[model samples]
Target: MSALVPALEVFLVFLRLGLTSFGGPVAHLGYYRAELVVRRGWFTEAGYAELVAVAQFLPGPASSQVGMASGLLRAGWPGLLAAWVGFTLPSAAVMFALALGMARWGEVEGAGWLAGLKVAAVAVVAQAVAGLWGQLVTDRRRAVLALGVAAALLVLPGAGAQVGALLVCALAGWHLLPAPQSTERGLPAVPVSRRVGATLLLVCGAGLVLLPLLAPLSEVWALLNATFRAGALVFGGGHVVLPLLEAGFVPALVSHEHFVAGYGAANAVPGPLFTFATFLGAAQTQMPPLWGAVIATLGVFLPGALLMAGTLPFWAVLAARPGARSALAGLNAGVVGLLLAALYTPVFTGGVRGPRDLAVAVLAYAALTAGRLPAWAVVLACAAVGWAVL
Candidate 1:
């Protein structure tokens, strides 16, 4: 009953987040902080922020991590499930429906509402960068790292930017910054039974690499493996996932044009940026719409859930060990650089298209930082403003 009540409450909170939370993962953090921490007193604002940072540093969706962590804090595993469903279901449903509709009706031409949605997405993501920048880009050394990473990625072809940037930052931070003051406060690293850990890793790896090879099942397998890889290996949250995802689908079977279009549409809708999977799924040539939706949804998210479950039990011990601790600290710093580069690529380049778009982004940022309006209101208003002005 105690468990049930908390789970139910979590479900309701996530449902609300699902229904109204606009903006992507970064903005979603603000919404979660405001609602879960400030309004409900579920956790300290610091705690929530830390979780977000850790999630960003790790290799899965930021918003999903937020939900999972929040649930674990609130009611253990069940809470995690509630948060996952609450966070993911709404956007997934919308994207799935849209995919089905698109598959049947074909692409909607001259979609003014969608155009507005894309414009608003730009503002939303830009606002996310601004908001996170305040949290991440403190002091000079880190700032330099951020700029260096952004410039490098911008200049280099197939730079493999995010992970590369992270590695650099981690090395710099390890050598430069002193050990953190708190011994007790650092994330607890738990070690799993090595046997179990090895087995799970092997299973996940086999499924991830091999699924694409077996053909009558190739499309289905490819969708699953690619998304699972995104969920499993590509750390540093949703924006970071953009590069990995783009690489996965583009110029292969899926056209670059479709990739761009689906991402634009994904940004327009509410819920997690991970819902972009639905768009990818819907676009598949071989799968039926229903099958596409199911495959996409599971393919994208399952690996993250499995990885987290497999990892968290052992992560505590591993994180605290001297070598692992040092490495992870560097990783954290690297994540800062990665996020900085991401700010330039997808969030800024995609969002700031012209003066009108720039104006909308600026206004949206101001409204978010100064006015403290709800994120949903910002999303709706920006959509309207984008339509009116653009």
Candidate 2:
């Protein structure tokens, strides 16, 4: 296939996913495996599995990165952009509209509806954690590492705490992640060169540095810098990045209520949680909603996208190493821990105010994980239930 042909194909496939894929980042991975691995035969099951590991190992929105990487596999850079755009468009549009409405109507008089979304987030993250646990936390050492990381974050909740957790996890992963029994793997091809991948990573880092310096001259550059850096450094993907983004924009650019509510609103959407950036951008008072939305969205997403452009080739080399695979497994478990930590405070505390709310969330969770109902349907059901009972 010509580059354009495959890129177009990727766009269409992911656009469909954008519409229907729900249950947050980890759930999106299951959907990707179904569509790309089982349905389209774009990759063998093992190949798709390896690709997901790569996405988990890198930063950005893990699901979005997986889609973009798949696109890159299909059609290089154009495919990367195509995959991201197609998957992101639906939720971004929906979020922007909701955001503008929030700015105008001022946080929806029907706070219950928004609360429905927050409670739904509780279910979504719980489902994601449960799904990841069996896969990532296989051994005792990894299990302890995961739980320890979660506990550490809970004790100290901030950007610094997140970075500290990852660093500690990295050390633990190195020690704990053991060599796999089977060395039965082949290296996959990538569109970028090692040099290109390295350069892209460097650029991401440089922007995180340089743009902050420019922030003094132009305020927008500060927002851009903050968002981009947050996107790049974030591991475990979309939901974990919340505190990073919250620190950047909250209390300064937007109010605490708007920021917290944006988190709730994000769970209600169908696409990437990064679209929370779109909501944040629009919620800001300094610029017009469209302009802020554009800036924040681009800033938050650019880091991970650029890092992929830089890291794919080198990642192929790393994946071949048993130590690296072991380390990635440990890190992934740590990621699950991070998600578990997030589920407690913000997802549980923010939404599950009373027993009635908890019941609604549990039902929503059962519908998603057990019933295997589509997440959109679950959200609708939860919202109506929240209105009536919660």
Candidate 3:
């Protein structure tokens, strides 16, 4: 199908998902798989699995990256753009509103609502890690890799550390893990040329290096640089960006409490966790909050978009290779490890300040596991419980 024929379909589908897909990045992928792969037959099971593998390997939000890749497969670059914009619009807008509101009443509102949001985040992330553990960690080798990566990141936590851990995993997978026989089911061809993708990738790297240097000249430049670096470096998506961005802005551009609170509030929203950038930007005093949100959001997500553009054309060919498949399996295991580490530090320790908080998180997790309540509903339920008891 041509780009135009699929552009509207892509936008509408993602917009629907954006309004309702709430558990986090992993949950978002599940939603996409159910809707696009299972229900719609948009792609084969192998194709969907390959997208997840590629997205897990790339920096930025993995679910968003997968969604964009699906778009590229469906109708080239325009469809990719449409998919991102549609999926992100609802959460981005909600986050912008929260950012503006936080400037006025963050402390007051955070007492109850944000508290519940925090615990809710804890529960949601826990659920995601639990669900993904089985699907991704099917073998003893991968299980060991997950444990190893999680332990290493917990001890030496940062974006750089996370990247290093992933590299180690990839190398281990390459040498230690047995290579599989190639099952080169050809993937749907995207319209982007290899040359076009390469050029975009080069631009992304240059911008990553140049943006921060320009920060001294302009505040916006600095914000972009910080966000760009956050986007560019990192293996695990969503919760993993926490450390990268925390070191970048906390106690300088934004306060520690606000940074943490924004994370909690972000969970209550639908769409990509990267929209947390929107909140961080709005929290900034360097520029008008909305403008800050816009630029920061742009800066943080730019690398992933450019990388997707550069890589989509070549992803199918590379993913079909047996060695590449093994490496990606290791990478997914690494992400699962990162998720476990995050569950302990930021998701659990950060939110569960006391017994009451832990209780709330437990209830939320139970609700999520029950599958009776949607994520947004669970978030609201937690908020009510927090106000009444927490």
lDDT (C-alpha) at residue 123 in model 1: 52
Q: TM per model?
A: 0.71, 0.71, 0.70
The better-scoring model by TM-score among 2 and 3 is 2
Writing each residue's lDDT as its tens digit, candidate 2 over 61-110 gives 88898888889987778888889999999999988998877654444535
Model 1 lDDT tens row, 238-330: 655677777666766467877777776677677888888877777777768677767777777766665554555555555555555544544
Candidate 3 lDDT, tens digit per residue, 48-85?
Answer: 65576667668888889888878877867778888988
Question: Candidate order by lDDT, highest to lowest?
Answer: 3, 2, 1
lDDT of 3: 0.78
TM-score (C-alpha) between model 3 and the true structure:
0.70
Q: Which is the winner by lDDT between candidate 1 and candidate 2?
A: 2
Model 1 alpha-carbon miss at residue 204, Å:
2.0
CA lDDT scores, all candidates in order: 0.64, 0.76, 0.78
Could you tally the backbone clashes for each prediction? 14, 1, 0
